[model samples]
Target chain A: MYKYDTYDQAMVDARVAEFRDQVHRRLDGSLPEDKFRPLRLMNGLYLQLHAYMLRVAVPYGTLSSAQMRVLGDIADKYDRGYGHFTTRQNIQYNWIKLEDAPDILADLAKVEMHAIQTSGNCIRNISSDQYAGAAADELVDPRPYAELLRQWSSFHPEFSYLPRKFKIAVIASATDRAAMRLHDIGIEIVKNDKGEIGAAFYVGGGMGRTPMIAPCINAFVPLDQLVTYSEACLRVYNRYGRRDNKYKARIKILVHELGKKEYTRQVEAEFAHLLTQGIEPPLAELERIKAQFADPAFESGLTDSVDRSDPDFALWVDRNTAAHRVPGYAIVTISLKPVGGIPGDASADQIRLMADLAKEYAFDELRVTHAQNIVLAHVKKADLHALWTRLDEAGLSTANLDTIGDIIACPGLDYCSLANARSIPVAQKISERFAGREGELGEIKLKISGCINACGHHHAGHIGILGVDRKGVENYQLLLGGSEGADTSLGQITGPGFDEDGIVGAIETATGVYLANKEGEERFLDTYRRIGMAPFKEAIYG
Target chain B: MVEAQIRFRDDEPVGDPAVTADSFGDQTNASAVRIEPGDDARALLPHLDRIRLVEVNFPGFGDGRGYSAARILREAGYAGELRAVGDVAVDQLNALRRCGFDAFAPEVPMNPADAERAFATWPDVYQPTTDGRAPIWKLRHG
Candidate 1:
């Protein structure tokens, strides 16, 4: 975790004071709602369906034990004893009061966190692989670059008020755990033929009403020029991205309207000019950020052994833990999705417990996965049984990771003002329907979004369900073959939409088709790709 | 009676020079000109030296096209007065200043005390913009 220096602290403190004054002005009726709305949104405050919701940025989804404790404190003291971790690796407190917002921001600032740029038409919270440092296949820990980008994008003068919201994701691993290809700007850290590490830029990939798989605009941008390249990309979008239609204002639409070649040409021309200006930070700055992410000391001869005598513990070890780059260490995922429960909702008590566990067992660091789960990235294999026991006590030890029971869902009509249909209830029902069928399902990634904004990332799910409004009634459309990995592809919608119950049944039918046709150890996504959507479509429609 | 709209030039209160809106046909000859959010700032670059004050209209604060225009003018080496007219608020003062707007002619006259406090909100910034502050990264590493 990057510790805040005096400069960083001053910036956040000033922002909190500024927001306090803005809130005071808004309350006094001096600043009208029209003028106040954008200010509040830029600070991560939103007027949701029931009340004010404040989305706090968990930068690149990494959290210190102290930061986690502060979040738990905020939830208990201000909100309704729980917080919802969002798909963007942020946490939203639904029951926030307009008056208490400044206080909440102040508390977050104390722990080197803020809700800055979490909302509005600005570069949002930059995300990266949750297992960035611990993953065995990672090329480099991407958080250093992510943190540098976070600094560069915060309150950026030129690109703050873009035509629409922009999101960036950085990933260094061979497999994409952060949905890199689904972001406005996806940066993959790659080594060039000369063995120098650089970034591979993918522009315009996003998921919404119109889902697009971002194509590679620039193959390899040198590490020193990453910020400059990103500036060029954003400059083009800010100047040319459509503003007449709010829905089509995203960079993806701009890239689509102007062919990818033309878009790339514009970006290249801007990049050339920006390079001449010498805009990128000095190389020492990169080294300074990189030093912050230095690996924690590991014991020389720790055993890579776990007690698998207990079948339940063994199942959890196999399902919830991932291989760590360092021997004797494991990446432990604490599943927030329990069967029949809401996805990504963690209680205040559970949060505190997770924080304490991270401090005690995992070197005081934790990560929030885009899949809506928490991870202790540096857990020792020897401590698995004890950690599992403690996690099981808190109801956090679900053996479902990428299983059908682990569903990714958004806070749809239940809490969101923009939602046309309910998503959590549907996710709960599907998770319940698929309980105890984890092994048989064979790695099914089911995602549900309440509306076409695709906050739930339904477009990237192998089994995607989109909630829609059909003349006053709730309906769902099923999509197949979407995956957000190294082989990124958007799901295609099958025939007609289904009612709530019909959609659950449709998922069951589709999963059943995969189960029947899958050959040898093939995942749901692999099987679907091999056979195409015909079998699944026939089962759902016919 | 409309309150005399306050204007600041280079962080100091300045007298409002009578700047009239010029028609598109006569814009090149006007010493003072008003540009709407929709107007291209690039078109005025050629006549920037003659123009004493450029008022960029922000119809709504949420519509940030004017910010880009102000930046484009400053980047194009326009040292003349760049005033952000209409829908300006205390919260946006620093951002407007960083984007190279030295003057603000907000629709509502801002309380001078509040505006002063807002301008002084952050003594330093992390990134280098048209604001001319050496980026904190450079300051730290240099």
Candidate 2:
């Protein structure tokens, strides 16, 4: 984790005082409701359907044990004992009081966390691969770059308020765990022929009212010019993005309307102007940020050792652990999407426990995966048994890693005012439908969003379900084959929308088709690829 | 005695900015700035200095044109009141404020007491915006 320097600390401190004053003014009636709304949103406060919701950014889903403890404290003291982790690796307390939010932010800042950019039309929390440093195929740790972007974009004088909320994601691994393709700006860290690290830049990819798979603008942006190039991208969007209609205001819509080539040309033209500003991030500063992500010293001579006799441990190891770049280590994913439970949700006590586990077994750091799970990266392979035992007690050890049970569903109409129906119950149904059939469920990513805003990112799921309201009844539309990794592709709509009861039946039927027709050990997506959507489409609608 | 003003409530217009959306329709002070989708923006750029209050209009609640306008106005050294007129709500007040609006006009009848409570509700904040400052955490601890 990057430790906050004096300047960073001072900046947060001053902002707190400023907000306190704003609150004072607002309470005093000097600052009217119309005047105070935007200010509160910039601070990550939202007046939701039932109560005020406060969204706290977990930058790139990285958390220190201390930070997690602080979050736990907030949940216990102020909220309803639990918090919902979001698809973007942020957390939202759905039932917050307007009066307690500033104090909550104060609590978060104490641990170097805050809710800045969790809402509002500003550059949101910069996200990256949750297994950034530990993933086997990673080129370079993407956190330093993510951190650099976080600093540069925070309250950037130029791009603070965009046409809509802008999101940037960075991934350094061969397999994209960060969902780079679905972000406003996606940067993939890759090495060139000369062995220099650089970024593969993708622009205008986002899942909102207008869903789009970002187009490649720059094949490779040199590491040193990352910030400058990024500025060019935003400047282009800021300059030309639609402001006439809010629905079409996203960069994706702009790219869609202008066509990718023209948008790229506009970006390059802005890149020329940005070059004159000397926007190149200082090399020393990069080094400083890089130093923050330095790998912890690993115990030498450790190898992959597991207690094969313990069925539970073996099952968890096979399902939950990923190969680490370092020998004798593994990247452990803590599944929050347990069957019948909310996706990306954890009680305050659970948060504290996971924080403790991160400190004990996996270096003193934890990561929130883009898949809405937590990762204790750099867990020793030899200590897998001990880790598993501890996790089992903490209820963090779920054997379902990416099976049907691991469904990604948003708060939907339950909490979000923007949602049209309930996504949680649908997810619960799907999970129940696949219960005890983990072996049969196979590897298929199912995502659900309640409305067109696509905060649930239904457009990017292997099996996507979007909830819509038809004649005052909740209905779901299913899409298939969307992937957000190195081989990114958009999911296509399968057929007509299904009512609530029909959705689970539809998923079961789709899965049944894959189970029967799929080649041996073929994932659902691979099966779809080999035989297109024709097979599954027949299975569901038939 | 009240002016035929267009007020923002919850980031939306109380009614249409103009009686109709076709034109600005001259008023005593034309705070209703026209946002040409692909306009060069050079005209708005220079005049930003002279404007004491910049009111960006949102045709609907979901229309986010004002967000960009706010950013551009703040960046171009417009230190004036950035008010979001039309389709405003109490829910969007915090976001508008963060984006640089210092005043608000909720669509509902103005209640001075309720307005005061709205701003004072959140005593601490995080994230930097057009207004620069550290959140309360850094102040008390760091």
Candidate 3:
């Protein structure tokens, strides 16, 4: 976990004061709603279907236990005793008052957090592999790079008002847990043939009205010039991205219209110029940031074994924990997707309990997954049983990582003004319908979104369900073959849409096809790629 | 009615009407240039030494191409009064200034007190800009 320096702290505190004044003006009716909307949005306040939703950025999804406690406190103090972790690895409070918003920001500032760039058409909170530092397969920690980008993009004068919301993801491994190819700019830190570390730049990928897989614009931008290269990428987009229609305003559309070759040429030209301008931060700054993420103290020569004496504990360990790079540790993912519950909602008490567990059992830090789960990244394998018992007591232990039960869903028509249909009930129904059979349907990644905004990452789901309003009736469309990992692909829709129950039945039917057709040990995604969408569509539509 | 023009420098008064980038070549006497959102600021690169005023129009606050226009002129060695003229608000002052705008001629009359506050908002900036301000990173590691 990277701690804020004096400068970073000063910047965040200053923003709080700035926003406090803005909110005061808004409350006094001095600034009109239209004028205040962008200002509030810049600070991550949104007028949702019911109340103002304040989204707080958990930069690169890492939080200290103290920070987590403050987040829980914010939920209890300002919001309705709960917070919803979003697909972007940020958290949103559904009910926030205009007057309390500034106070809430001030509170977050005290904990080295703020809601800046969480909303609006700016470079949003930079995300990365949730398992960045602790994963066995990772080449190097990507958060230091992500943090550098976070600082670079924050209130960038030329790019504050981008054509559309821009997102960036940095992944060190080819596993792609953060859905690297689906971001506006995805950087995969890779080693060139010369054995020099650099970034593979994928520009202009997003899921909106149109979904695009970002193409590799530059194969190897020397890591030293990563920020300069990113700036060059954004400069070309900002100067040329469409503004006539909001629907086609994202960088994806701009890159699509310009073609990858022309875009690459333009970016290379700009990057060359910027390199001479001394735009890159000193390499020592990266070393400074990297030092903060140095490995936690581990007792050497600890055993690498977990007791499988209890079957329930064994099942939970098998499903929810990932292999840590260190021998004695495991990365434990606490499932927020409890069966038949609101997918990502955590009560204040539940959050506080997790924060305590992170301090006591794991390291004093936690990471939020894009799948809306919390991870104790450096838990000793010896403490697994005790940790599970504590979490299970608090109803936080649901052994559903990457299962059909671990569904990613958006706060759809229930809380979102932009959504056209409801998404939660569909996820709930499907989760409940398949909870008993989830073990048999291993590694099925299900995602749902109320609208085409794809906030639920429905486009990247192994079994994606999109809710649409067809002639004033809520209709659910089933999409299969999507995967957000190493082999990234958008799901395809089956024939016609279905009603709520019909969609649930359709998933059961679709999975039935997978089970019937799957080769040994093949995940739903693998079976789908091999057999194609014909079987799922035939089974789902028929 | 109050002072809409906030100039950083004492030099001014290019009495010749500012011409658009398209007409800059046509008018030899015009020492001032105006850039629309779509106009290439580089069009005036050849005439930067003589141009005393460069005004970039931001017809809408949300349209940010003007920022690029200002930066382009300044970065191309345009040592003149680069003005941001139109739909400018107090909130954008810090950013507008950072992008190399030394003068402002906004359409809406902003509260002078608020404008003063906005100008004094950040003592330091995060990114290096054409304004020659060292990014906080450079200040840290310089």
**Each candidate's DockQ score against the native complex?**
0.56, 0.09, 0.73
Model 2 chain A lDDT-worst window of ten: A273-282
Error of 2 at A236 (Å): 1.8
TM-scores of the candidates are 0.96, 0.83, 0.98
lDDT of candidate 2 over A469-518, digit per residue (tens):
99999999999998777778878899999998898888888888888888
How much does candidate 1 score in TM-score? Answer: 0.96
DockQ of 3: 0.73
Cα lDDT tens digits, model 1, A429-492, are 9989989999888698889999999999999999899999999999999998899988888898
Please give, as one word, the docking class of candidate 2.
incorrect
What TM-score would you give candidate 3 relative to the actual structure? 0.98
- Flag regions of model 3 displaced more than 4 Å: B1-4
Best by DockQ: 3
Query: What is the DockQ (computed on Cα atoms) for candidate 1?
Result: 0.56
Query: Residue-wise lDDT of candidate 3 within B102-135, one digit each (tens)?
Result: 8888898788888899887776778998878888
Best by lDDT: 3
iRMS for all predictions?
1.5, 7.9, 0.9
DockQ of candidate model 2: 0.09
